[model samples]
Target: MNSDWLAGGRAELAAERILDAVRTVFIDHGVSGVGMTEVAEAAGCSRATLYRYFENRQALYVAFAGRETRALIERIWRDREVSVDRSPAQQLLDQLTAVLAEVRKTPHLAVWFEPANAGIVAQLANSPGVVDALAANFVARFRPGLSAPAAGRVGRWVVRAVVSLLTLPGSNEDEERAMLRTFVLPFVLDEHTVID
Candidate 1:
């Protein structure tokens, strides 16, 4: 891997391109259903080349999760779907709803929530790294003055809510919104957010 990288190939760019290919494969075969060979083939790279970038299935999963989560979060905020005029609680609700909608619309992401893949999705979503990043970026913007650990706790709860909903959505958006209002908002925003 290093030798090829040293020979002038951009490893990061190669890895990202492979991941892009991996997404369409995941769409065809749910995240858990896709094998490494399938990934390598879809990436149009030899298995050795794929493994050079991603050591194994788990590494690929983590890399994919990190990349996609960051992209999704960036898109949600960039869209400005959550209005400034709304209360923080409403804004939070809008953000959560936006995440669900976004994921559902994207085939690769939607497949990740398939019943067979839900366990893997849950594990990755609840991982400390994901939670911490979400806390530092997402939670911090809403729950200012909270410590990193505190924000992380909030982030974990949010992840749980998201995974649960993704795995088993409610009958309708109203019900989902209500569930978040009843279950999520209290714990996440239990402490009043200090807006500046």
Candidate 2:
């Protein structure tokens, strides 16, 4: 979206344009490095206009993450194949790995997990907001029978695991997969094992 579209009665479009600009800026400068002023210039708008859309950098980050999470979920499920032959563990592996792969592949999203920026992510996640909602929604697809609260517990656990691996990966993808299979899968994939 071009800056010309940032006029009256187009608040949503203007916000999206700002976010698009932020994504580009994030690829060059890690999430922590991006500033509201830089985003304004990138979006071809004044700092006042940028602030009108997003009160602050944190607000912008939340909006971007919220928009992208829904889109990411769609992409993840679009490529997913459900087969009776596939074991539950394998399915969980595929789901988790797909998330890790997608996050790593997306420059804007990956920047959040960069070691220096991971702390910012952690700070945002401590509150029961986007992170909790994202994790719950992601896990609920696999454990549809679990209640909201139960799913939340499992989801928080999954987010922590993902963040840990993203910030400090194991030796390689193979090793990371092995660790997830051993430590993370059973609890999340096995309904018999209660998560309290």
Candidate 3:
């Protein structure tokens, strides 16, 4: 095999190994508690090798968030496609439930809320290329009257709210759903209250 091709294959494998390590670290230690040294040790690679793949801790966190975010968007899209007969509200509720549950379960999801991880949070807020694309597509389907930009903004807000709730210690599912209906959905919909 060509040397360039061999090197590229190895690089891809190394990247995967590092990402798997990142997942473990993020789960074991919250985003605020994890450091590059821990991630390197978890991956069984030197700090230099980890740095080559990720410039800094913030960059690694960004990659971690990006990976999980993509998986979530894909899941939502897949579920929606299968529910072709469902009403828009029902479809959206299903998608939101799945995505929110995953975010709550994923350790790195806290990255979005940690002030120290501002770099990662800025990436989500300022660029949000992946999140934006998913929002635009999904919003276009469910809320046709709203522009893509509006939907994207609402999507970001929902994500932020979810992160806030996830970071707290003891909010149950019923409480979360109530909070969503009371505090979140109404604000997005521009409603004064949750009628009935």
lDDT of 3 at 134: 60
lDDT of each: 0.81, 0.82, 0.65
For model 1, the stretches where C-alpha displacement exceeds 4 angstroms are: 1-8, 81-84, 192-196
How well does candidate 3 match the true structure, expressed as C-alpha RMSD? 5.7
Best by lDDT: 2
lDDT of 2 by residue, 45-106 (tens): 88888888789888888888778876886788778877689887888788788888898898
Q: Which tens-of-lDDT digit does each residue in 1-196 have in candidate 3?
A: 1224225557767777788888778667756678888988888887888899899876776666667777778876776574668655555556666667776565556444555655545555555564666655655565556766777776666666655565552366777676766676555555332222
Q: What is candidate 1's lDDT per residue for 1-196, written digit by digit as tens? A: 2335324656558899788988999988888888889988787777888888889998898888888988998989989665668998998888889899999998888888888997898778766675467546687777677887777777776788888998999999999999999998877776764322
- Residue pairs that clash (backbone atoms under 3 angstroms), model 1: none
Name the candidate, 1 or 2, with the larger lDDT value: 2
Per-candidate TM-scores read 0.88, 0.88, 0.69
Candidate 3's TM-score: 0.69
RMSD in Å for all candidates: 3.7, 2.3, 5.7
Measured with C-alpha atoms, the lDDT of residue 189 in candidate 2 is: 74
